[model samples]
Target chain A: MATIKEVAELAGVTPTTVSNVLRDRGRVGTATRERVLNAVAAKGYRPNLNARALVERRAPTLALMLGCITNPFYPEFTLQTNNAARRHGRFLLVCNTDYEPDGGSGFLAEVAGSLSDGVLVANTGSLQVDELKSIQATGTPVVISVWEFPDVDPGIPCVAFDSHKAGYIATDHLLDLGHSRIGALVGSEKNGIHGGRYKGFCDALRARKVKHLKTDARFGTDSYQGGFDAALDLLTSTPDLTAIFVSNDLPALGALNAAASLGFNVPEDLSIVGITNIELTSQSRPALTTVAIPTAEMAEKSVDLLIKLASNDPDAPAMVRTADPVLIKRASTAAPKSRATK
Target chain B: MATIKEVAELAGVTPTTVSNVLRDRGRVGTATRERVLNAVAAKGYRPNLNARALVERRAPTLALMLGCITNPFYPEFTLQTNNAARRHGRFLLVCNTDYEPDGGSGFLAEVAGSLSDGVLVANTGSLQVDELKSIQATGTPVVISVWEFPDVDPGIPCVAFDSHKAGYIATDHLLDLGHSRIGALVGSEKNGIHGGRYKGFCDALRARKVKHLKTDARFGTDSYQGGFDAALDLLTSTPDLTAIFVSNDLPALGALNAAASLGFNVPEDLSIVGITNIELTSQSRPALTTVAIPTAEMAEKSVDLLIKLASNDPDAPAMVRTADPVLIKRASTAAPKSRATK
Candidate 1:
């Protein structure tokens, strides 16, 4: 409740000296600085941040917009980004878009209008290219995470992982186990990542010279329900399938549940592999065998890139930080039975 | 970006009229408003949000601060709160505290200076009652979620669930299943919710005339690894235990995995029940039989309460929203084997 004038008077310093102390800049003697700090602490004087932002044209805060909060994947990214930001003494303002295209745009617009020094857009599958471009033009440096825009040039720094490679690695692991008949429980292909994963799955099958069954492909929601429904459909349609590759860990978990409900033993009747290798994947019934994407590493690197961009460094290139998709073979995957192959 | 004057001149309206149209306020003619809107759209005029906020002395943004972004529980809460905020056409800013006592206070101070219209403080176990009161004194309406202050009343609103009842329900379910030797895998007692749940667990055992063994208690992180370690310790120390009630689903999941790795059959050997039946719980190997807390509903209602409190509504009481914790009986829990009793 104490005012800046009161602190200045108590410290025997001018209001300008008090302001300089708060900003941690300008020429001031060490004794004077100590006296100003002590007086400010004694009086409990809080700086007026809005007025300061208006004068300085900087908020010292960054905005991180995520597609969905319930997905657990975004949180992994946020956790790392937040820590990195804090290390640089910056604040991160997070917002969840809920995977709505209009909502993503709306949130981006709001972030542009706020006191954020920069914006970190992550997994905004629903946002159109034009909307992204317009937001980028708002003078706020943006770092896009996980997903990439084809039209976005090197000017827009992007932090992405190889989703296509992730899909291939997971499927290849299952196939290497001598499981020939494989089904893919994928998310909606309307988004780029899901589409990329689907493409990779097809490419892997074609490369292996296996009979690629169109009926084996099942599309569902981006959630567990989607995975559950897709698994049910795939199982009912292709009863001979020996392995299944899901697009993400969430759906993979759903598949695990659906498989259990259907009285099918995992790895024994049907092998399952997923991407993202979320925390729950390890804790699940049969620990999920997944393609581990380095979410935290990606987040940390993206913040560094964005910080460089915000500092007006032109040398900072659009970084695509892709981690090697390591196959975490667990109890969920195994070799196909000779009797089932025939 | 075109200035307000340019748009106003082109639209044949005064700058004040243009400002009113931009703010969606004042009694302006429909035709004039349309013309201003068209000119603004054609010229690509963006109202300087910083300037507007400076004039209004309000940021027109709400901030939600959590313990950590990696915790999926916070994200789940954020998703629902965001949906509600979006419906009301308000922007949300999220910040993560990382559950550090000093760091949490620093984040709160930073948020307090950010000029947010309101704040929703979901403290991790790190925050004390006095720190929360100090934050509330900033005149910014705060809605405390997950944790409750014991003594301080800063005229701020709060939204909390009955964690004790949740604990009681989970423990009672295991007891009702004829499991006498129950081990409790709880979070640190320093955490408000964990303490409440622990008390409830003790009270349930007392009501059932069962001897609650203090040696069966273990304290550690609120993660899967923590649960795994705790379960391992408890199992070794209390070999006669037939059931375990975990504080949260994440740790409960770890316990499940530890049980499997230790060659113990769930239900037949060791029955388990967890709180916060998160999405991963139901999707786990045996499908976790736990208590389901209405996280999304609580998030929505919390934001609604905060909004009301911010509007200076005297009708808003110091409310605590209690959602019924439903017993989701799954394969994880069953009657103990006759051999265990013998």
Candidate 2:
């Protein structure tokens, strides 16, 4: 209800000085700044960010396009990204693309350059690379973050971690427990979104000269129920398995419950490991063993890179590599009971 | 990168006509509208939302201040709110105020009537009512959504739900199943955020003439770990208790796992009932039985109320009440074993 003119009149300063004081731009004396702030408080004058954004040719927020917020992983990623954006005095406009009919094409078209200054695509697996490239072409900086494979470039500025290594670490943890008869439950197809992790699982088996039959692996949807059904089918058909390596944690949690329902005692009858140690991993029964990826680092770096790109910084690199994933040995894994007893 | 002028020139129409077509306002011939849309697509012109907002004196976004985005409940609430806001052609600016020292006072000050046209306060329990009133006084519509106690108004526009009824139904379910030794786990103090639910629980016991003691109730934080710790303590202290009434779903989940860790089989050794049937309730082992709150309805009503208030509609009611909570019976609750055997 209060205007800048009233605040300026009360503070005994020009409107430009009030603007500078509010925006924290230009050199105003400390006393002048305090007076202006006090006047603003007294009048309850709120700055119009939309007008400022128009004059500055920059929006005050960055858009984060995520597949699904309720999936648990995106919430963690969204929180970190929200905090990182806040540190820069910017807000995060989160767009859930899972419910979109065109897989967010319409959302990207309307939001790429208007509602937000930059766009951060958190779910690159489902979104097309060409769609991201087209958005980048519109001069609204676009950054693909949490990209699974470091080797595969989307031809856009992105932050990537070693997915292959993440898979390798989770599988190696299972192997270290002398689990010769192993099974694999991949959330995605053999060469779909989780290809790198599945590849890493195979390499871990090959490195130890362990034979993996065609029936030893199952590929299905990348979700908890997917993991549950796949694990149920795999365990029922191959009851001799001592360990199972799951590509993602959500499905692995489902598999854990599925295993329990099937009368299998975890860490005694079977050992299971998962990638990406989300918060729920620690809360589940037996405390899932998993590989902890650099979720926070990736989110922070993605925001940093998007800001740089939006500012037209030529020094912004095409790819930002984060720390490698490491194994967190929780209670869900142990040596095979037959070998332990022997 | 293209401007409206270029699109107008290509469409053989004035810039004003182009604007009318793009905004779906005023009158334009169907053939002319198609031509303008074709030109817009061909030229890749993006209407600046900030400029449009400045001209209309209404920002194209709404600010949603939530306690934490990482909390599973917030994500579900946020997704529904986002979809509802989208239907109104507005974007959502989510602010996670859990990390803030003042619990979002600063967020409210900067975001209200500036970056966003209206503000939706999702977590009213922890926020100060006076702070909300101050924002409302500034000519910005502020809606307090998901208010637990419908009887107590915060002197602002809000959407209310029957928390007392939710608690009563959950307690009644247990009482009907022949469980007399029921312990209560409150996610807050006796008169804190969950007070309404606790009261319902007490009233339910009194109506049935079932004796309850101060030692039978434990008050603590509203989270999984909070529920876990309290349940562990309660179960250890009162091993004869055959059922538990939890104030919220998240804490109830933690209590369920805690019971498992203590070697108590759910529904067989103890029946547990929680308010709020969140998605995880069905996903958890034994599929927790809970009272289903009208989450989606509340979110939609809150957004609708905020929009109406922003438009200065005189007929907008002070309070909007959603549908009542209902019981969702699942594997987690059953009659006491002693009664079942008889």
Candidate 3:
């Protein structure tokens, strides 16, 4: 119920100063801006929307699409992306593409006309990139995250994690543990970004002169159940393997569960490592050892790119930005026990 | 990039039928509506926003504010809400209130002018209801979730889980296992909605004629670390307790970790139960025993109410809709063993 005049009075500033601060128009000193913001918060002042629209033309709104919102990795990604987008002065419109046939193409078709100034698309499942293109075709800018465009349309910019290096590092860590027979839980989807990790795993084996055994790997969905089944199969079918590199943490946790069910203690009998160290990884039973994707970095860069593209000419170099990954050591990983222990 | 004409052509219907189906207008048969929707998806048809805006006086958009987007309990809620809103012909705009200084008051200040037709507020922290009131004062309808409108304004409708029942059930389960000496980890915020659970826990204990121990409960932020620290403190200070009821699942997982580090075994030495059956509970060290709230149902009803309110009168009965909770028996809970067995 507080007015601009009351906020101005509380901050000891003129009403014009308060108005200017609210509109982000006039050059206000940092201290004065902070004071005005504090007073606004204390008074719980909301500017009249109609008046705001007249003052601030073209409401700057951006839509963010998470193709698989159910994936544990996305909630954090969305939190960071939403925060970053807000910091850049854009109100975010989030859409969950889960359960949508053709990876949200239907919803996009339904609402694409009213979408904000730009769109940020995350989790570019196989069917998503084209849907994004259709959105862009509607004259809105689109920023793709967590995947390569794979096409030379130069239609949109993208920001993604370095999954290839993630795979290499996880393999290196297991190799350093003095394990020659290592298994991997390859992603169920052949087109998944996790395939980068599989590639890296294969290269690391080649570099270390460790023979790659195709039979030592199992492929399934990127779910805990899939990981559980894959790990169970890998451990049972390839009994000599001492360490396992999982595609992502969800499956890694599943693999750990499989190890437990099979009477094999983690780190003591088998070493497991995963990628995308989601929040759950740190709190999992044994606390999974995994590769941590720089999701926040990707989020910020993608939002920045989309915002920049929205403001400038349509042809603002549609570049791709990549963020590095980190290795987090937790209890699930340790030097494998003596070869005889297996 | 498929056109409305293309969808109509594919579905063997006139473009008006396709348009009517898209806009949820006119008397369209169910079978015809499905055929048009299928054609729309197959053709990837996106309606033109400017044309639709000119056709319909109101721009049917709904804004959903999540006061705590990082709570692990919200992603699924958001997904369900977004889908339901879409089904009601409303585009959902989501905002995360986590990092906002005034619990989303600041963000509301900036975009309050450009927000959608109606507002759906969830997981409201302290400063939110007033902000919602301020928003409603803009002649906008607002639907609150998970909190009482602390004021006498009779402000808006709310849909919340039956937390009291959850608390009572979790406690009664533990008591059924003959756990006379039980501890609890309550949420830190005195005004938090989770307080309902604490009240229920007490009522159940009192009903069983068990004297409540004030010192047996610890309060902390609803997070894993908070639960861990509180449970650790409780275990170190009150070692005789055989059961613990945590207000939320994140903290319950933390409590499990605390018991493990304290050299006590779960289900055998101690039992722990948590609320908000998050996905991690099933995958936790010992899958967590939890009170499963009907989040999807709450989401469906809240969105339905919000859309209806947006279309109907704002004063159309500010009803409180509460969904029931279910108990999920997981590995983290079990009857305590006799000292003789150990």
Q: RMSDs, each prediction?
A: 3.8, 1.4, 5.2
Model 1 docking grade? medium
Candidate DockQ scores, in order: 0.56, 0.79, 0.39
Write the residue-wise lDDT of candidate 1 on B1-342 in tens digits: 678999999999999999998788899999999999999889877777667777876676777888876666777777777777777666677777764448677777666764577778776456665776777787667777654322334344676677778889998998888888899888766354587777778889999999987898787647889999889888988888999989888889899888888888997999988888787776676779988887777777777877787788888768656566788888899889974566
Query: How well does each candidate superpose onto the true structure, as a TM-score?
Result: 0.87, 0.98, 0.86
**lDDT by residue for model 2 (B212-309), tens:** 88898999748999999999999999999999999999999999999998999998999999988888898898899999999999999999999999
TM-score of chain B of 3: 0.83
**Top-lDDT structure, candidate number:** 2
lDDT string for model 1 (A27-77, tens) is: 999999999999988987788777776687767678888777777787877
Off by over 4 Å in 2: none
lDDT of each: 0.78, 0.91, 0.77
Model 2 agreement with the true structure over A171-224: per-residue lDDT tens digits: 788777898899999988899888999999999989988888879899974798
Q: Which pairs of residues clash in candidate 3, taking residues 3 or more apart in a chain or in different chains?
A: none
Off by over 4 Å in 1: A2-36, A99-101, A148-156, A202-211, A319-323, A339-342, B6-40, B99-101, B148-156, B190-192, B219-221, B314-316, B337-342
Q: Which window of ten consecutive residues has the lowest lDDT sum in model 3 chain A? A: A50-59
- Output DockQ, candidate 1: 0.56
Docking level for model 2: medium
List the lowest-lDDT window of 10 residues for candidate 1 chain A.
A147-156
